[model samples]
Target: MTLAKGCTLCYQGAKMVLFVTGRCRRSCWYCPLSSERKGKDVVFANERRIEAPEEAVSLAERMSALGTGITGGEPLLCIDRVNEYSKALKDHFGKEHHIHLYTAQAPTKPELEQLAGLVDEIRLHPPRECWDHITDTDYIASAKNAKEMGFDIGIEVPALPGLELLIPALPYLDFLNINELEWGETNAGEMRERGHELADGVHNAVSGARDWADELLNHGKVHWCASSFKDSVQLRERLKRIAENTARPFDEVTDDGTIVYGVLDLHPGTRDAVVARCRTFLTEDEFSDCGDRVETAWWLLEEYRDRIPGKKSVVERYPDGGMVVEVTPL
Candidate 1:
């Protein structure tokens, strides 16, 4: 029911997602990146696309972020970018701003050493083919290297069948994260080809994925993240956290982390009259002029709808970022 430390911060909206790049050396069949991101060299801070490192910092400030998780198609491939952003966050927020990284690459000592001063944790994803015998891969050396260089080292992999091989290597790791296999727009075909199917009533999770995680929980170091938990708990909590920090005076934060507000679309000629009317009838704290529309609390607008002109709606949108979730036309 609860997430790991890094993931828990993420769920609480304290951890910002810093996607440095989408170029990876390994081709994991179950990667859930969307078509716009997979195999492409793009940078995103949560849902906002960005061109510079400072944009991520600005976005983090907007959400009152306490930490960041550096992810990518393969972050190590873009080591310089990782170094830049990681150092930037720590510089701006101070060292207590927890930062972690996810990579499939078995980085060298120099690369890890560069990250040690900025990154607090390093999670390695060895190829799925090596899941049955993790000790045989370069991940062992990389994990030990990360540990020695003062990073909280751990292994993160899909909770696929025959993952018991990773158990033997747990002694050298600080923690182990097993993610439930998932199907997405970009990886659906590959998932089906590998004999995975959606769990009944669950939209994207691979069937029987949770069962694979059960066999490993006795190890104490293992953290099993069910697909449902990621979709429902983690995402919602993050949204709520952002909503609390970023909601405008006229916006109402919902229990689910969405913001609910009333919008009145005004004609170019009638905008002046509407503004005058709003100013006369509503208190300064109750309304805001949002370019082409007037925004106010849903309940306040509903209480005085008869006095307001033009097409009106109660809109619910994702908190802090993302798009509109619902609009009730009035």
Candidate 2:
């Protein structure tokens, strides 16, 4: 099946996720937003928190992004923020940098007008209760309006029952994306309340979710995103891209996109002598002297383990000084 441009970029790990705000208007039972960002008014470029819209440009460049996906509590709720960031990206990356936005609210002429030149695509997420009567809601008109306004319009919804009811609205859409329904920390209780169980013991995918899309698969415009695929393929690809761009000469990039390096835990009393000793053997670029620790090539640290004076370990972590994944005492 042909993927949407945004989906294509995502599968290739070329799309940077730009989270503008965490303040969503609707509280969907299946919202997977983390607790740290669920209702907080925060902005994130992938995993890095930033204060300005322009910061997204640098982060996108770090991952060598070809496109970006704007998502939030609801992006339409803050049109100006959307406009600013989209404009910054387009200005820096040019018009060919594909941008798609996700919104639960249907856009009228005004909202579509604001997004007209900046956004390349718009994905509507009409609430499940309205799926059966989507034609009667503003969503259909929004889709039609969005299409006429030169934006590729589509509907994106979790793979759930009653999706077939959206058939009547299909003629107005460029595509339909059905995401595998999955358990989320915030909605796990609600999911259990609805009597849903994991499709398997391992992944968060809900049982029978894909069955809901069995008939829709035949349609050329329809696409199904499995939870496992998102977690394993899409995320791994994105991480690899980041690792390639951010990894230093001393850092070992793994297939999973994490970086491995040796760390020297320093004590206040012996920090200077240890650093002096390290400087004799390690080149200026071979190690980074963090306030409390020193990081260098894992093999270099291994070879000089007996010579250095502090606790030492091999550490694997996310790129760009991100969270540590593992630490083994050396």
Candidate 3:
């Protein structure tokens, strides 16, 4: 299934997003990713790991993705991999497969020149959180340089209430994609201490950021995105889309760190073996017609909880003789 164009990122299932490496220059307290990037080898996608270009293309093919986005601890931090990923995708998927990037780095002319042929767009993120650290000119210069360097230039940042003092400093930017700040694995306590509380039914994300984005949209000073809200909404309305888009079935991951889908399958005379030993769940509730395929009925198996194979392996029928069902929804 092709990703819908409404999504500014991953609109077309482009797993082209490469978390080149997890090493950032700054550490914002509200950072959702936490310290996971510091010298870590996690090329984190949206609840996914992108290891190699081949695997990426495989996943994309499964999802029927049309493009790719590369971001990270700062894509420029690992320029070689950035070059590698960009070149590989453009080469593999062709140039029409939109490739975009996000970076906090201020690349020089030579660096931007190097990336010009490789990247179609560059989203500069000179964060507003650490005003004491990075400079205003640097953000503008980076945005200006990126535009000059043949990249679709824009700025991306969290829409913090404190940013009112900082937005005008970045007029050179073509677009400012301000995301709603949400608490995640990266900065739970920091956000709590800052008095960023949940907006009622909302989970980890605070309401202040919503007010922040609405104010920006009202003023029309910049093009901002409350992406977290959109993403949260997508989890439900887009379920059929998710099921249809999935190359291989995967569960969703909620903000509370819960895996929404859990399935397990066992082989052969588990009908006899599992049923005989099965204590708690009734046989009829567990399986209406148990075959090689695992139906929702089979997921009700309360017996042999420790012995059930993962769903993936059972679907693929790996040599290990047990199915493996992973519980992660993106």
| Strongest candidate by lDDT | 2
Question: Please, what are the lDDT tens digits per residue for candidate 1 over residues 1-330?
Answer: 333467668667678889988898887878899988988999999888999989999988877889999998999888889989988899999998999999888878888878888888888988877777778778889888888888888889887887777888888888889988888898888887888888866557788887877767877788887778776887677788788778988888887788999988988999999988999878889898876999899888898889988889999999765789999997
| Per-model TM values vs. the true structure | 0.95, 0.97, 0.69
Tens-place lDDT per residue, model 3, 28-111, is: 666676465654757753445667767665544543445667776767778888888678767877877677777877677888
How many steric overlaps are in each model, in order? Answer: 0, 1, 16
The parts of candidate 1 lying over 4 Å away from their true place are: 1-4
Give me the candidate number with maximum TM-score: 2
Span of 10 residues, lowest total lDDT, candidate 1: 1-10
Sort order, TM-score high to low: 2, 1, 3
Q: Which parts of model 2 are misplaced by more than 4 Å?
A: none
lDDT, model 2: 0.92
RMSD, one per candidate, in order: 1.8, 1.2, 7.9
In model 1, which residue pairs have backbone atoms overlapping below 3 Å? none
Could you tell me how far off, in angstroms, the CA of residue 91 lies in candidate 3 after the best superposition? 1.2
Model 2 lDDT per residue over 60-124, tens place: 99899999999998888788999999999999999999999999999999999999889999999
Better of 1 and 2 by TM-score: 2
Clashing pairs in 2: 24-73
